[model samples]
Target chain A: MTSEQDPRPRAVIVACTDGPLLVRGEIDLISASGEAIPRTRKTVALCRCGVSTIKPFCDGSHKLVGFRTDPVPPADRKRDEGIVTGEEAPPDAERSGA
Target chain B: MVVCAGSQGVDDAPVRAHCVGMNAFDWARRSGGPPEILFDARGPLSAHLLDVLQRPVPESGEMLAALLPATEIALSQSVDVLRDDDIQLALFILYGLHYGQVLPADEDWEWNPSLITARLALEREFEKRLRSCVPMPALPEVDSDAVAGALFDLTAPDPGPSLSRYAAKRATPGQLLEFLVQRSIYTLKEADPHSWAIPRLTGRAKAAMVEIQADEYGGGLPERMHSTIFAGTMRHVGLDDRYGAYVDNVPALTLTSLNMMTMFGLNRRLRGAVAGHLAAFEMTSSIPNRLYGNGFRRLGYDTNVTWYFDEHVEADAVHEQIAGRDLAGSLAEDEPQLLSDIMFGASACLTIDGWVADDMLDAWSKGLSSLRVPLAVQSFATA
Candidate 1:
C-alpha cells in the first residue's frame, strides 16, 4: 500500500442539486481568459445561476433565483414569491463547459 | 464615557475602573486560558454563581445546592428574560462552565445538577422567548435541496439600514473598537459554540460539519485558526485580544447572542437548530463582513486589523454552501421530524442577530456608546 503512486490531487466539484458548483481539493481557478483568480478558502461555491451580484462566486443567489436542476413539484416552485425566471440564463452554466 | 439614556456618566467611571482588577482579561493574559470571570454580579443569580466559583468544589457544590431554588425563583419572575442583566449573566456564566477560560472554576461544575438546574430554568425562559417572538418561517420540504433553499432564502442579506453599512462609512475609531468589543464576546471563542453539535450529528451532516470546522480551526495551522486570526486583528488595533476581555462591556443582548448558540449546540435534541443556526450565520456573514472590513480600511486600519473581516468575506461564501446544502439540509433529509426546528432555528438566528445590530445602530445613531460600559481606549493608530 505504501509503494502505490498517488495520482494528482484532482479537484472535485460537486454540482449541488439546485445551487452552485461546490468546488474543493487542489484546483486552479482561472478566468475565461486564463487569469488566475485568487481564492481565500480551500472550498468555494461557483455560481451556477448567473444572477449572483458577486460574479464567478455564488453569493447564494441560486436560492434567490429558485435555480433548480431536478424537477420540483410545479406547485412548490410556483409558490408566491422570490423565484425569478430561470429560462433566460444558461440551462446549467457549470455543465455548459464554461 | 458611556452616557446611558443621557445619564451622568462620571460616577460609574471609577467603578468601571475597579472592574479591571483580576478580571477576565488579566486572567486571560496570564494563563492564555479561560479566565475566571470577575465582572460584578448584576443580580442574585450571578452573585451566587460567581461566589460559588471562588469556593473549593465541595463548598461550591453545597452553595449551589442551597441557591438553585432561589435562582429558579428569580428566573420565573423575570418579565423580560432576554434583557434581564442578571438572568443573562447567570446563563452566560453557566454556559461558561462548558467553555473553559471564561470561568476559572473546577471542571466538575460542568455537569453539576445544581448548576444545570439554574441553566435549564433560564434556558427554558430564553427558548420560550425566542420561539414566541422569533416567528418560524414556513417549513420547506424535507430534502437537501429544498431545506438549503429555505435557509438561503431566510438568510438573504437585508438591504436596509444596518450596522455593517453604518460602520463602513461613518464610525469613528472609538466606535469601531466598540464594534470589536461587541463581537469579541463571541469571535474570541469563534466556532466552539456550534462545535457541540458535531458529536450529535451523523452521516453527511457530520462530515460536512467537520469539513467546515477544519477550516474554522485553520486547516491544521493554529496560527491561522479563525479565533487566533481575530485576536491578531484585535491586537493590531490596540485592543485586548483575550477571550471575554470585553465581556463586561457588552450588553445583555450581546450575551444572549452567544448564549443562544451555546444553547442550541449543547443540547443533543436541538441538533437541528444548531445546524440551522450555523447555516443562517454563514449565509448572512460574507457580505456584511466585507462591509465591516471596508469600514476598518476606511478608518486607516490595514490588513492586520481587517484580516478577520476580510477572511470571512470569502470563507463564509464557501462555508455557506457546505453549511446549507450538506450540513443543515442533509440533517433535515435524514431526520424529517427536525425540519420545523431547522427553519425555526434559522429564523431565530436572523431575528436575534437583527436585534443585536439594531442595538448597536440605534446607540450609534443616538451618539451613545453601545457598550454597557464605554471602552476607555479612545486613540487609534491613524492614517
Candidate 2:
C-alpha cells in the first residue's frame, strides 16, 4: 500500500507549553551517535528542558527549575514585532530604502 | 431492593444461620477450606454488612434495613467522617463490592439494592465532607493550556513535611514496611480507578487517558503492570503481595485515599475530577518516587525492591505531561462546564493525599507505627 493508503495512524509530536514534548505513535528514538534509545512506553515525553536527570526523556525536573515557553505562534510573534504588519515601522517618509 | 425477612440482626439469626449452614456445606463440597474472611470489620456497620454478605441473599423481606440506620448513626456520631474508622471501613467494603474479590461474599450482593442505597448514603456524606474540607483552587479559563497551567501550579513542589523525604532520610526499616503496606491499598491496584473514566471521555481526552492507562497496565505485559511491579516490590520487602492483605492494618485515611478515587471514577458526573486527580497525582509522583527508591537503597535493598519507584520516576514524568495537557487540558477545552469540577478533583487529590502523608509522617516522627495495627514483628533483611 502507498504511504497515504496505510491504515495505521502516523506518529504525532506535541510541544506541550512549558513542559516536555509528548510523542505518540510508533517512532524510533535515536541518540546523537545514531544508536537507538531504549523507549519502554509507546508514548514518551522527550525533555525540552536541559536539566532532566534522565536526559532525552523528562523526569519532571522542569517544574523545579521554573521552565517556560513563549505561548505565541512564531508567525504571530514576528507580526507583533512589526515584521509583517509594519504597525510600528518608521513613518512612510522615513522609509528611504523602500 | 432485596429485603431481608427480618429487620434486626437478632431476629434474622436463625435464617442467616440456615443460609450460612447451606453455604458452608456448598463451600465444603467445593473446597478444602472454609471461605476466607477478607478483612476485619471496623464497627457495627461493617460488621453487620460483612455478616450478611457471606451468606446467600434471602428470597424474602428486608435483610439490609439496618444498614441505612447504622450508616446514619455512624455519620451522626463521627466528628470527622474521613478519619472515622467505622465509616471509612464501611465505605471501603461497599466500594469493594464493585472492585470484586474485596469481600468474600455472594456475588449477587454486589448489586443488592439495599447495599446500594446504604453505599449511596455514605457516599453522599463522604463527598460532602470532602467538598467542605478539601479546599478547591481558583478555576482557570475553559482552555486546555490554561487548565494544564493551573494544575501544574497547584501541584508544584511545596516545602511542607514530606513523607517521601522521611522515607529517604529517617524512616526505620519497620517504617518502610509500614509505608509499603499503607500504599499497597491503592498501588497494588494502580491505574484501575482512573480507567473508569475511559468510556466516559471522548476524542483527544479519551485517547490521552488510554495512552497513560495502557502504560499503567504495563503496556500489555502483565509482569510490567504497575500493580504487578508493586506486588513484586511488596514481596521482595517480605510483605504479602495479595490485595487487601494489609487492609486491616492501615488507618482509615489510607482507605479514604483509594475510596476517593473510586468514588470520583465511578460517578459519571465526576469524570472531570478523576482526570484532574490523575494529573495532579502524576505531577506529584516522579520526584517522591525517586526519594522513595533512595530510601530503600539507603537501607541496602536492590533493584528488585526499588524498581517500582524507579519505573514510576520515568513513567509518571511522561504521564504527567500527557495527563496535564492532553487529558485534563483537552477535557476542559472540550467540556468547559466541567472546568471547576476538574480543578476541584485535582485539589482534592492533593489535600487528601497530603493528609495521608501527614498521618504517616506524624507517626514516624513520634517513633510510632503508621498503621492502625502494626505489622507482625519480622526481620527486614536487606539484600
Candidate 3:
C-alpha cells in the first residue's frame, strides 16, 4: 500500500450514510455554470440534501430536513465489501477504487 | 501595583489591594505579562487558590493546605456545583494551569499534586452532577451508520427558545455585545479543549479529529484560525480580543460550558464524551451560525464583523458530518462500552448549552444584561 506506484486513487469521496458527501484529497469542485467553487479547506463536505443555503458545500441542513440516503443494496455492497468492512481501510475507502 | 506582603506570603492583600479601585476586567487589560489572572475570587476556595497562585511555589505550602477546607465549604454551601461561581471559577483556574498562560503562577505548579487533588475533587462532583443532570438519549447499535443516524436525530432542531433566533430577529445592539462577551470565555480559546483528545484517540476517530481540527486551526494559515477570526470580530466590535479579557464579565455558567469540555477532553477515560461533545457542538453550530451572521448583518455590521459566524456556517457544516460519522460514530463502534457515554456527551452538550441560551434569552426578555457585569464599552453605533 505504501508503494509509490500504487494504483489506488488519491482523491476519494465517502457518501456518508444519510449525510453529506465527504470529499477528501485534491479535487476541483465546480458549479453547473462551470465556475470553480472556491475550496478553502483540505477536505470538504458537499451538500446532498439540496436545501443547503451554501450550495456545493454542506451547511448541516441535511439533519434539519431529515434527509435520507437509500440503503445500500446487498449487490452493490459486495463490490465495496472489503473497503467498507475492513477495519484497517483508510477513512476515505468507499471510493478508493476510482 | 501592590507588592507581595507578609513572611508566610499567603495573604491575598496585595492582589486585593491591586484590584481595589479597578475590577479584574480592567486589571487584565492593563497587565502586559503572561495572561494576568483575569478574574477575581468568587468565594473562599477561589480566593485562597488565586492567592496561592500569585505567590512563589516554595511559599505556597501554607496556602495550599487551606484549599481543601475552602473547597469543602464552597461545595457544601452550594446547591449546584455546576452553577457555583466559586467552585467553577476555581476549576477554570486549575484547568487554566494545564492550558498555561491563563493562570498567573509558577510553571512548576502545573503538576502540583495538591492542585491536582483539588481539581480531581471538583471534577468528581462536576462529572457526577453532569451525569445525573444531562438527559442521556437512548443508545444506538455499535455501528457507525446507526450511531451517526442516532446523533443526527438526537440533535434535530427543536422548536424552542433559541438564542440564535433572538439574535437574528430582535437582539438590541447591547444584547449583541453581551452575547459576544458571554461567548468569549470559550470562543477565544476555541478548539484547544477538544484538541486534548488528539493523542488519546486512535485510527478513524483520530483521523477525523485531525481533519476537523486542521480546518479549525485555519488549514495552515494562522491568520484564519477560528480563534483568531473570533478575536477579530471582538476587535471589530470595540471589545478587547485578548483571551480571558472578558472572564470577569461572564457568569459562572458560561465558564462551566468550557470547563465541561476541558474535563471531557483532558481525561482519557472520558474520550468518548469528548467525541460526542464535539459532534453535538458541530451539529448545532451551522444553522445557528447562519442566524448569528444574520443577526450581525441586521445590526448593520459588515462582513468583517460577521465573518466568524459566516465561517462557522460552512466550516461546521463539514465538521458536523465528519464529527458525527467518522469521529463520534467510529469511536462508539470501536469501543462499544463507550456507547452510553457517547450519547451522554451529546445530551450534556445540548442540555448545558440550552441552559446558557435560556439564561441569555431570559435576561434579554427582561431587558437586562446577560453578562454578570455589563460591558463598559458601548456597542459601535451603526450608521
Off by over 4 Å in 1: A1-9, A16-19, A30-40, A47-98, B1-36, B381-383
Give one digit per residue, the lDDT tens place, for model 2 in B240-350. 655666788999998998899999999899999999999989888887777788789999999999999888878998888888888999999999898988999998888
Q: By descending lDDT, how would the candidates be arranged?
A: 3, 2, 1
lDDT of 1 by residue, B247-301 (tens): 7889998899889999999999999999998888888776667667878888878
Candidate 3 or 1, higher lDDT: 3
TM-score of chain B of each: 0.90, 0.90, 0.91
Q: For model 1, what is the C-alpha lDDT against the true structure?
A: 0.75
Query: Candidate 3 residues B246-292, lDDT tens each?
Result: 77889999899989999999999999999998888888888788777
Model 2 chain B: weakest 10-residue lDDT segment is B1-10
Chain A TM-score for each of the predictions: 0.67, 0.65, 0.63
Model 1 scores a TM of: 0.82
RMSD of each: 7.6, 12.9, 9.9
Better of 1 and 3 by TM-score: 3
lDDT of 2 at B237: 64
Best model number under DockQ: 3
DockQ of structure 1: 0.14
Candidate 1 CAPRI-style tier? incorrect
Report the candidate with higher DockQ, 1 versus 3: 3
